[model samples]
Target: MAGLEVPTWDPQTAMLIGAILFEAIILYVGYGGLEKLVGPRLMELLVGGESGVSQ
Candidate 1:
């Protein structure tokens, strides 16, 4: 019987995973920034209000 083999470190796979993670982080931050910049304006346009509620 043969012994168990060790797993090899794959540089390409590591880089690909790292790049995907980095892109996800960037997209998250960018979306948050975009939401902060445009969310209020969009809400105001859609709701048409100087105040939060009419009450």
Candidate 2:
């Protein structure tokens, strides 16, 4: 019977994956903060005064 082989951990691959994950997190947080800072103003500009329901 053949046994299943376990995958080995490669430091370089791990580092690359970590870097990608870090960048993704940074972009997410950065964009979220930027949205918070500019989203309302942008919406108002596009909608022409006020961003929500009117009445």
Candidate 3:
């Protein structure tokens, strides 16, 4: 039987993982910013005319 061995580290795999993580972080931040910037405008467009109306 073969002896157990520890897994080896690979630079390419590390870089790819790092890139994916970076991209995810960037997308999360960008999406949050975009939502904040556009949310009010979209809400206004959808519900703008009812502001002065009585319940």
Candidate 4:
């Protein structure tokens, strides 16, 4: 692979990976919090007035 530039690891790569991991963790936490906040309402909406009997 002539003329192809090979990338090297540096502080920038570390920061990039750290940023990605931080974002993933933040996203997971945010979604969990949102589900906790909205789960009941969503269940009611999806389940309707059926209340108990399952199909």
lDDT (CA) per prediction: 0.88, 0.90, 0.85, 0.86
Better of 2 and 3 by lDDT: 2
Give the number of the best model, judged by TM-score: 2
RMSD of each: 3.9, 2.4, 4.7, 4.0
Q: Name the best candidate (by lDDT).
A: 2
The model with the greater TM-score, 1 or 4, is 1
Which residue pairs in model 2 clash with each other?
none
lDDT of 1: 0.88
Ten-residue stretch with the least lDDT total in model 1: 46-55
TM-score of each: 0.75, 0.81, 0.70, 0.70
In candidate 2, stretches whose alpha carbon ends up further than 4 angstroms from where it belongs are: 1-4
Tens-digit per-residue lDDT, 1-55, candidate 2: 3668777989999999999999999999999999999999998887777756676
Off by over 4 Å in 3: 1-5, 49-55
- In Å, residue 28's CA in model 3 sits off its true spot by 0.3
Ranking 1 against 3 by lDDT, winner: 1
Candidate 3 lDDT, 1-55, residue by residue in tens: 3678777879999899999999999999999999999977787787775353447
Ranked candidates, highest TM-score first: 2, 1, 4, 3
Q: Which stretches of candidate 1 lie over 4 Å from their true place?
A: 1-6, 50-54
lDDT of 4 by residue, 1-55 (tens): 8879887779988999999999999999999999989987787788865353476
